[model samples]
Target chain A: MTQISLAKCKVDQLVKLCEEFGNQEGELINVLHKAQELVGYLPREVQEVIARQLNIPVSKVYGVVTFYSFFTMTPKGEHPISVCMGTACYVRGAEKVLDEFKRVLKINVGETTPDGKFSLTSLRCVGACGLAPVVLIGEKVYGRVTPGEVEKILKEFN
Target chain B: MENNITLKIDNREISVPKGTTILEAARELGIDIPTLCYMNLKDLCIKNAPASCRICVVEVEGRKNLAPSCATRCENNMVVRTNTMRVLNARRVVLELMLSDHPSDCLVCAKSGNCELQDTAIKLGIREIPFAGEKSEFKVDLSPSIRRDASKCIYCRRCEMMCNDVQTVGALGAVNRGFSSVVMPAFDEALIDSECTFCGQCVAVCPVGALTELSHTNRLINDLANPSKTVIVQTAPAVRAALGEEFGLPAGTSVTGKMVAALRQLGFAKVFDTDFAADLTIMEEGTELLGRLNAFLNGDKEVKLPIITSCCPGWVNFFEKQFPDLLDRPSSARSPQQMFGAIAKTYWAEKMGIKREDLIVVSVMPCLAKKFESERDEFKTNGDPDVNYSISTRELAALIKETNINFMQLPDEDFDAPLGESTGAAVIFGASGGVMEAALRTAYEIQTGKTLENVDFEGVRGIENLKEATIDVDGFELKVAVAHSLGTARKLMNELRAGTCKYHAIEVMACPGGCIGGGGQPFHHGDSARIKARAKALYTEDAEKSFRKSHENPYIVSLYEEFLGKPMSERAHHLLHTCYFNRGKEIIEQ
Candidate 1:
């Protein structure tokens, strides 16, 4: 079996975040989202613990985790970049930005770097058409990005 | 209508039943309130209760934050503005968020024109999305009757609501929460492995291409490529009446001959008619009905009550699900579609001096459950399934286009002899109350031992979900009830369960308006087109054919004389008639 690391600190932090929201009973999804955000992915163990605390079945937790496209159950690199490829973003050259990310990292979408420094993924339009070709790296939204700007954007994350 | 509430929608006040949602009231007032989760009236009351998707948000004068009109009950003197800028902006934002994770494959997606999400996007004039998120990647669940792609789901819960509330087959429900919430069967099991009846009701209600009908053309194509196989195709009665709609023809255009020509161009060895077997079904079912009536009148030892019609597999499956205890009430006649398959593999195969295995039988039907029926263990006569592949009417049109068949230029041709000729009674089987009408036409004459002056049972003909009629024949009053749609059938069944409904026979079809509005039929905007097409085609087919009655068909009479000996004969009972088992356990196990 392939051994996977637990995002233990991030999981505790996410549970606390859910508690802050005053949604203790209804915070499984919120906690999962925060956990994914902190650790860059939601591992199976994180989901299990969340399921237990929430009094929801592990299978139910896994089903929701597997159903939505927004949730990832694997580990991400130190820095994660998501480029918007939604219809608006697509028509406005988000694909070019994505291609640039693929070239700079030498890794496709959903791939992490060999050195575990950076990861890339494509997203649907992020509702910011005015800021077409938007790229999000660790809560920072880089607007009006071009293929030429990808290397510059990555250096900051590095 | 004692407790009606009047509400103002877009400046127009309309009085609707109390507890009517703002959406329903708006709809009643000719005010269009855009909704993602709502499907007509039936979807209004569903658990999880229109809470997930906030797209149907509308503004009320006194309400804070946008209210989902689908969930909010209408109040007297309530002023609802559906087209306000705030409501539009909120809807747009919600749509943008939903689209943020959707796959960018609409060009090749099956739901391109018919997709609600795409329609909403275009309607909202949303040029872009602002949120960047990870796109969900999922493998396609290509089961027998439906395909599921979780990647495209907006999770509006329309399908889940329809499955749980309307059909009451809660095979699907939301599994996870926020962003990760995916609708799936229990334990993420394969749909085919689940108790899913493959009714395609989920597909019919799905807003996006998240759910779709599985293509059977690949298997048919493979059969056509094999030299050893003699592939024979049969078109259902409703298919010809509606296949033309997909080709830009008007809704009710009867393209029976053109359909035959199109099939010939597709290179099938023989193109038969399910209508022929429909006539055969009437013979067997009619006789069975007569036998049951006789048994009941005589107080026979082994008598089954009710004698429900079994022409619709969806209804059969529904009965198996909700009314397992009443399985014996259903007549033992195999559906005409299944009977056609059995006869094709047995009688036709023997007549042509070909082994049943070498004969590839394909049925084109206005139903998706027929796909599941073809796979049923009871449908098999020889070592293999009688029907190898079942394609929907829309799929047939797609296959025709795929082969580049010139549908317009093809000359009208008759179906192959012996198994292709069908009576007018068989043709009308596509519409609601058609089975009851056909059975009455034949049974009246058979029972009274005299030919009736007027063969048309006008009392039983129409588009009503539940119709009751009593005919005086040979000084005996024969009472019959016809119900289209499982919801309506449930109402009649409740009456039966309450001992209030007493009838000699009844016909129940699972789909509303019978096979014409079947889940497999072309997507009409509303019931008007469906009802018009069904009514026109049914009456036209009846008027055109010489043999308007089932017993009057020479081919059916010949079939009974040559092979089966007579209607309801021991051989006929073996091949055509079947026994119903309590399917509550079977469905759960599946």
Candidate 2:
């Protein structure tokens, strides 16, 4: 049996989240979506809690988290930046735009800055191929973004 | 039969049953289809044809492109071209892509000669990889029994299927996406950190160098070479039936004599058989079973029903982690390997007048878990392991070859005396239901004090995951269930938990076909027939024995009369009996 975590409050929340889904293994994705929303990220500890609650192995939960593009293990910064690497965006110089964001932010893709104010990540298709080379910062989207505009985009977050 | 589908492969017509895949149909037609990630242990309910590798793509006539024969169901009047130029080109291109990211260290790979990937490459005649790109790099994860190198994995998912589906351990699964995707435990932790039972089924089915045993050959060799040490080796019952396969002997061929000769040639002072201890185990375990049966008959509520066998180290580890609450339900008798080691360290050493420190006892087992079992703290005495260490049947073969011992030509020799003498009952312990059958031969006679007319309990035999039989022994219908894989064992355990199991006893073997199909045995390449063959070999050896009962073994009778005093005696408990640990809480510590 899975012992309750020492951090009782958050673990209670995780247990509650799993109970909400009736602890069905088929609801792993839905539970994961809500759990990620609640916890901000799916760390190994959180995954173990969910695994115990759902009566599944931690490896299965981790496999699912690692398989999907949206699910992430690390916490996102307040000003999380995502550059689309979709085929359409790539055709429209998204690589250059992504590199410019990395350069200005001084953080690699999937990494956060030392100050933790900004995190960089790459996305497949934001479903905004019409707005090629799109970059998003916290809900705000920048379309037709040029490498030259990367500095201005960071200024808005600042 | 009426719904049989007709398909033509290479213009040869063939009719197959419905739901038969194109790959099976093609193979039936004497066409060998090159495949990756398409393993099918038909009778065992283990399959990995995820169609991810796509190496078995065939040109299905009228289709726009090629179709994966492994996943595609053969249709009526379907025309398939397996060796078409287009199919060949597609297959080679897929191979090149896999090889591009794969490490080119075939020479040093543990699976170099026997790797399915290498064989497939050679079969396809792939010369050079045209497409080179970044490879997935993962830190090597080494457990006591298995080593995992994600970089060498070709995404075949065979190990994943074996670990998750076949064994139901769920210690491994595919993680990440696209090229970064690789199979591993959560957080890619070392295998020991996960709930891995060290069953090594993953290692057994791994087609490449991604999964291999953690070889301890060098340590064993050094111990053998030490002049000051008196080295003795005990071979497991299952080893003789399968060790010949590594030297090109057909599967299931009994090489006991030759194996003994080879061991002797390799400088071991004495070569013993674990079967002797297996016979001793039967004497002890059989008595324990009868005690429980009598207690239940007397309305003792505390006596747990359906006492499970504890001879398999893998099964022992599984229950310790997954079913800790039922730890007392299993027999406390140590496995034959450990029992042999304990007796060798205590009784044999005492008789020989050799200090225990100078005596080195090694086990040659057909299991990887036995390697882990020997080093366990519970199996140790005053910081010294009862069994100093153990090597797999594969490792023993390697040692024999390295020592220049001709295994095939060597004359068959009998096992040494005192600790090596065993009966037919012990010999059959190599098979899945063999232990139960062996125990019946003794338990029945001991309880009734009558001669057992026929020792063969054929009802307990077969390779099915779970089997049940009832024996009417003097009005006591002893219901026994034999379960050989953890997946199947889980079902029986669930029955016990639900209060639905009425069995008086159950035998559990973690590997598919008991020890004969153990993870450390010569690789069967997912062919279960070889496992059946090995089991048959053990049966043949059993039939050849004069004494067919454990209680009748002269050596066991003497051991009890002299040292043990009787079954379940204090001295017997000190050496032959062991306890189970609750590993259920261990996995969560991390």
Candidate 3:
């Protein structure tokens, strides 16, 4: 998934993305993909704009957007933190590492800080089992993460 | 048959289509397989078998784990065990888990007797709360017509399917995830804030009390008890054909006489029929159609052709929100319900030597939108509504039972005069193509100045999504079209927007089978056969009537001559006619 924020595009850009898919009913998935690619998220307003341009119901768009986990309605913050919770990482001190990050960030998993500077999310294996407790901060991978290392990693973004 | 697949369930062999699901094949052999989240409504083209509930899981011979019968398609030589020890335990466990999270207060529940989950639990012989956990509590949303009690929701997704697939309203949807998942409007907003047409289709298909009609029974009961107020009730044509189902009568049974008798016993001062006003509607709407047709024929391009019928409140809200630019295309005459309310409160109230404020007109309808329609400010004077209050046919049945009135044994009765007389044309306003046929019955004869040999317009009579028929009126071929359900209306509207529509008039009802399948009628439990039966009852009533045309009704003729000068006259326009406003932004004459 493209984790970086692409919500910088104008509202009209999402409408154009839907029209570029020929506004066909069968191309709903393709149109949603292109619109999400431009807007980074499918908020209710963006979905309504796309629904009008595609001549489809907003509920239909929402159904498709929700059926797939790759789509998100809320925009990711500037620095989204990920703590791997796969079998390899969980056997290690990944649970402690995730708790430390939550304590330092003062936000639960799948939540963004009030300042929008950082987001805490959990993921499965990133195929980097060598570093059992892996943490990613905005596309940067940190191997062999520790409970005490969470503060240092968050400071790197601020 | 081609591509036949043989399957065996509980040692019974059966042959079915290749794509038939295991649940369906088992049903074909009279083997009942339990299900929770499966709803199939073919008439509206809505089938919701997500199989997420897992209550219909069955054991396959070779498979290690059980498979959902609803989703698992039958294969040739497939061996399925529907009621084995393991399958029974699994179904019971699923029900227990669902009940653990669901509220157990079924005594006061709105859908106490009709809930599918409750029936299944009883069939399973569940008695204890073995598992207990935190229940998902959601704030109840009570709109003008529908109630959303998310705490009672089983995540069946029936309401979601109806809104998304059938009506295309897109108001209700799945929100959140995991244990907190719920069906709600976009961003979890209230339904009134969303594009909900208040068609009540969601309430109709819901198998539990999660979704239900907001009861107006209490307010009406209080009104009926007040001696200072004169409470008069009007019954819709569709209500008489379908209300019988609530009283243990068959689906197609017409209980018109019994319904009138029950209304009288309920202590109403007067019992009226909205069909009388439906005939009045034809007089006004038929006149409007012919005037537009004549104008278009005389080379007047300013008048919009294909004058749409605006009798359906759901259809009215639809075009206002979805097709605001073409609001004037529909007839400005108020619906039969509204017309009866306006005339009863004004014309009849004056004839009875009473003030409009002292008269309270209650309507028993097969619609939920009629509740919202009566609340519109344009149809009110000094904050008093034209129709004081409207209740659904379901609510009326409950009131009858509450008052200890045995509906089955009630003697036959007749409707009061002046505003209670109707013709066959008015009785047909309940079905899908009934309005188009009624208008054609009168418009054809008036345009040709000759009697119509065949009053039944067969072309616009079935449950087709869109129907087209052309009538030869005085050597003029008047092309007309009819469509029921908002989704189908979208297609016809698109053709009109493309400038490719060839019809001179169109009739649209938001419900699939028109008023008979209304959101407030007795629940069919997603059975289209019941809808067809109700339609048959209305047609049968029409055939039995002495006068089959709107203009031929003696009361309507006297209504025009004694009071209103003629159709579309200044007096008729003031009492019977109304206007449409752009309702896209939700500023409903605020």
- The most accurate candidate by lDDT is 2
User: How high is the lDDT of residue B417 in model 2?
Assistant: 96
User: Which candidate comes out best when scored by DockQ?
Assistant: 2
TM-score of chain A, every prediction, order shown: 0.61, 0.80, 0.80
Report the C-alpha lDDT of model 1 over B7-30, residue by residue, as the tens digit.
788888788888888877887777
TM-score for all models, in order of appearance: 0.72, 0.95, 0.92
Residue B447 error, candidate 3, Å: 1.3
Overlapping backbone residue pairs in candidate 1 total 11
Error in Å for residue A113 of model 1: 32
Model 1, stretches more than 4 Å misplaced?
A1-158, B1-34, B41-52, B56-64, B67-85, B134-142, B174-176, B406-411, B491-501, B525-532, B586-590
RMSD of each: 11.6, 2.7, 4.1
> Candidate 2's error at B204, in angstroms?
1.1
lDDT of 3 by residue, B1-590 (tens): 57589988999998897899998888878888877788766675668899889999999999999999999999999999999999999999999999999998899999999899998899888998699888999899988888889999899998888787778778888876788888888666687767788999988888899999888999988988899999999999999989999989889899999999999998899999999999999999999999999999899989988899999998888888788888889999999999999889877898899888899999999999998898988889899999987899999999999999999999999999978889999998999999999999999888889999989889999888789998888888889899988888888898998999898999999998899999999998868888889999999999999999999999889888888889999999998888887666321111
- Return the lDDT, model 1, position B520: 77
| DockQ (0 to 1) for model 1 | 0.06
- Looking at model 1, residue A33 earns an lDDT score of 79
